[model samples]
Target: MAVRMEELRDHEAVRAVNRAAFGGGHGETVAELVAALRRDDPGALSLVAEEDGEVVGHIMFSRTLLDAPRELVPVQTLSPLGILPQWQGRGLGTALIRAGLDEMGERGVPLVFLEGDPRYYSRSGFEPAAGLGFRKPSLRIPDAAFQVFRLPAYETWMTGTLVYSDTFWRYDCVGLR
Candidate 1:
């Protein structure tokens, strides 16, 4: 029931949790992307929820960008937030998200964005990004699925196309068009 950030040594367990949580190619993508992000940005955080020695949930926040009308601004993105099927509905995922967002906010991250189920993310203060002047690169994303959350005072920084890390492009989450 306790959730906290995992150290680098616990990396494999985090991948295993992602594998079980998403159950497909997405898991593989999660594992690969996690590794690349850590290698590229040691400042990135990979979080997990551990219960009785097992990792039941996982989430990641790393450097990303907002491509505004004429320039790119640094931002951090929330991605691959997953709770193992057996652990779903227990609120571990929500706790992981709240913790990650709070940690980022306290550290002065101006904004955070994600692509996820609106019904779920909305409860955590996320609203459709397009409503905030942001756009998803892929049209496959439903309007309701792309969302952003900015501290009330920093909402101005959330606009424009989200540019994920190069790993995203390598894996086709970006530059796919």
Candidate 2:
């Protein structure tokens, strides 16, 4: 399948993809989070991968602040990356991630954070956030799963405790940690 990436404008399609991709007790929560982020975080970047005019995958990056003692470093975090179960292993997820990162970098985003498998995300240059003085804002997340990818505009002084938007916590999604 030829996957085309674009900003997610079809809320219904995106919701369906999220529900199917993360199906379980957590699927609806993630889908709700996407809707909440759309309303609460205007600066958030939400993209979808489409094939044959249908959304097959989705990824989101919401604007956040790293509360360093001296300054609030602006950054974004990757969350709720999803690909249809049937579409898994076809590189759609990877393509969505790469496209999101490139767009963030072009927009001058300094860093990107995510909580996921290091074995999978490491392929995209993500490294342990702790190693770079970045601390998880919540204790619920494991240190090993919390990773960061520094963009071209990243600076050494951008390290600090991450602060996510209320939408993340309200939805009780991955951002809770």
Candidate 3:
């Protein structure tokens, strides 16, 4: 499978993948959130995993902010990574993530944060954000779920609270309920 930047033509496939990956009501919620993010966050980084011209997976990274002491540091947040149910365990998710991170790194994004399974995300170079002196935007986020990947552009001074975009709150996706 090849991972690449998502194009306008892949929107429906991306939505279908998200819905299939999450399933039921939760899938619908994620699908809606992704649509809203696409419309609201202009800086969102969206990637798709395609095989034989068929899009089977999707991932998104949105620009967020770090409330640092000196200034608000612009950062990226990875969320709602989805692979079609049949595509799970094929490493498409990892490929999309690595591609997204590489793309962000090329753009000089210092840090990428996400709320996910530590065991899974750690393989992609993500560590607990708290360990790096960054606070979660919500108390609802579990310690392990709040993870970060420091890119080459990252600086020690960038550590602080990660402020997610308003769309996340509007979707009630800040963290576990």
lDDT sort, best first: 3, 2, 1
Please give each candidate's TM-score.
0.90, 0.93, 0.97
lDDT of 3 by residue, 1-177 (tens): 888888998888988999999899889899999999999888789999899999999999998899998899999999889998887898998899999999999999999999999999999999999988999999999999999999999988988899998999999999898
For model 3, the local distance difference test gives: 0.92
Q: Which predicted model would earn the best lDDT?
A: 3
Over 4 Å off in model 3, which ranges? none
Give one digit per residue, the lDDT tens place, for model 1 in 65-157. Answer: 888876777778888788889889989988999999988888788778888889999999988889888988667777788888885336564
Candidate 3, residue 141: lDDT: 97
Over all chains combined, what TM-score does candidate 1 have? 0.90
Which segments of model 1 are wrong by more than 4 Å? 152-158, 174-177
Instruction: Supply the TM-score for candidate 2.
Output: 0.93
Name the regions of candidate 2 deviating beyond 4 angstroms: 1-9, 175-177
- What Cα-based lDDT does every candidate model obtain? 0.81, 0.85, 0.92
Residue pairs clashing, model 2: none
Predictions ranked by TM-score, top down? 3, 2, 1
Point out the higher-scoring one by lDDT: 1 or 3: 3
